[model samples]
Target: MRAAGLEPLEPYPGSGSPWCCRHEACGREVTPRLGNISSARQGGCRYCAGKAPIPPDEAQALMRAADLEPLEPYATSMTPWRCRCTTCGSEVSPTLMKVRTGGGCRFCASHGFDLTAPARVYVMQHHQHNAVKIGIGGTAGRNERVNHHRRSGWVLARDWHFATGVEAHAVEQAVLRHLHEAGHGPYLNRDVMPNGWTETFGADLVTPATLAAIGTALLSSLPVTLYCSGSSAGR
Candidate 1:
């Protein structure tokens, strides 16, 4: 125990039993089994191992610095901490470790299609499978979602950029609902298009043009607060 930076607080307990010791570095009382410590299976002190109990005030300050207001008292670092996003005013629960590692509010993340950020709704066609797909994604420069499909043998038939992902997603869902009501549900299995098979449909049942038209009609019907722009078709 001395070699491991711990001083025994009492008489020796059996090797398999819990032994009380004080960590010399952090002065924290920890109960660890001698057998486990001797076998190098467990650390001598949780505090020195970075598992110490964090003061509530310190945890709250860390969350506030990340633009999150805690909705409840702080819990374990690994447990979800309920909070409200100062940026988007959305309720979110994120772990302390995740926050410490630089994760922030999901609703305001640029890569996840922030609701108030620009996004795109797309219609894709798979020539080999005679299928079509409808989806929404961020309108960032890369357009990774669409490019991912292109690499998977799906051609972009049409895509429209909207002021926000909320609008784009609304249009995508409206079009998908129309397809589902018209008896054009998912046609591909997970094996073929593992990433987006749930959004795919048989081209014979509904053409890519039809899907694009539905999306366009829905986009036009949305409130004036939402607006969109056209983009060139294909890859």
Candidate 2:
């Protein structure tokens, strides 16, 4: 009938692409595999190597659920996504199409791109309030600095040098001020900033320690950031 739930795959319905014997009509009837639809008439199936008859309507429904409509011509090919790319006019490979969320191909990522600007979020770890370390991910277009780091031997290098004047120090102050105004002080959410989210933001605000606790936190948790402006912030 309609194939035992999941027996025969789509496109190649009705004809199981059988192979057959060709011993000069010795009364043999082996179902040989189906031939290339383009050349089926001359090449035939598995048993007798005959033609792969067109699939009946029952099998068509199965193909439909697989998002493979417009059957009948399926005998020519089995791939579900047999279409041309709208952009480059190239044949979109079926393998690539299968991985996407919807029924579109890889070209879908660029076809209807939204070119508008995206809002940016800056992150840095804030400690007792003296200094901070920054980390950044990708370049936010031409305006933002590219975050990068290089290591030599045991020492690690954190450099956020931008062709544009995106010095991290100034940006750190701005972020600190913004955090201060937001009353988001003494932040315990150091987990959210990630390893090097502030690199693109530029540099940290370093201030002399006013108390032993501040120095201990700064040295021990070298990970946490200083929240105040550098210089005489000891007050």
Candidate 3:
């Protein structure tokens, strides 16, 4: 068996049968039902072969369907690429397979926020526009959350911290609903932002008084754990 390129390892036990053959080429522990190791054909790693390099065109098409335009020349599907994401109009580098699998802007997703952890609700302001966005960032820390938005050309105006994810989500909804009812539709300068779909409101409309009122309403409606007094001063 060793002369035939089969590396014999410990005997593999099966129902009423045992095999004494193993292949190191593919790193498989046991060769299923080997009569004689000599007749067993040597096959290369099946796992690597299954992950064959994907064609550039197919990868491009997959990216296009996900509203992402490749920034670099297309390589293999595994290559990392800088791409323009239409979902948030941000330049992001993600693997071809990730985009193909319906992955979207990382900033918008809060860098895969962990729902099981405490959530931080923030009030972010647009650098060049008179707008503010109220949002939630889960276990993905506040600094990371702000950095993601900043990389996408947004500036963090304020961060409203909450003790739990539930509190933040509830308050965020309250703020959005209040803004939407006020006819701003929870978006300020919506047409100006590139693919802007974040929950935002006009700077003039999102005054300190308005935020206080909305926060108070949320505090009353939600559990006692929901606190709004710890909000950072607006920038």
Judging by lDDT against the true structure, name the best candidate. Answer: 1
Tens-digit per-residue lDDT, 1-235, candidate 2: 1111112223453444543333333343334334433344543222233223323353344334444443133332223434455544544333212322234433344432121222112232233332333332222454232222222111112222222222333333344444445444432233543333322221132322212223333333333333323221221
In model 3, the Cα lDDT at residue 56 comes to: 76
TM-score of each: 0.52, 0.16, 0.44
Model 3 C-alpha lDDT versus the unseen true structure: 0.61
**Winner by TM-score between candidate 2 and candidate 1:** 1
Worst 10 residues of 3 by lDDT: 41-50
Per-residue lDDT value at 63 in model 3 = 82
Order the numbered candidates by lDDT, best leading. 1, 3, 2
Q: Which stretches of candidate 2 lie over 4 Å from their true place?
A: 1-162, 165-168, 186-188, 191-235
Q: Tell me the tens digit of each residue's lDDT in model 1 across 1-235.
A: 8888889999998999999999888787898888989999989987556567877898898899999999998988866699999998998887787787678797877655566778888888889999988888777688888888888888887888778877776677677767777777679987887766878888987788888778767765775244455544333
lDDT of 3 by residue, 89-118 (tens): 977666775665567555556546554467
Per-residue lDDT, model 2, residue 143, is: 24
How high a TM-score does candidate 1 get?
0.52
Shift of residue 3 alpha carbon in model 2, Å: 70
Q: What are the Cα lDDT values of the candidates?
A: 0.80, 0.32, 0.61
Displacement of the residue 102 alpha carbon in candidate 1, Å: 18
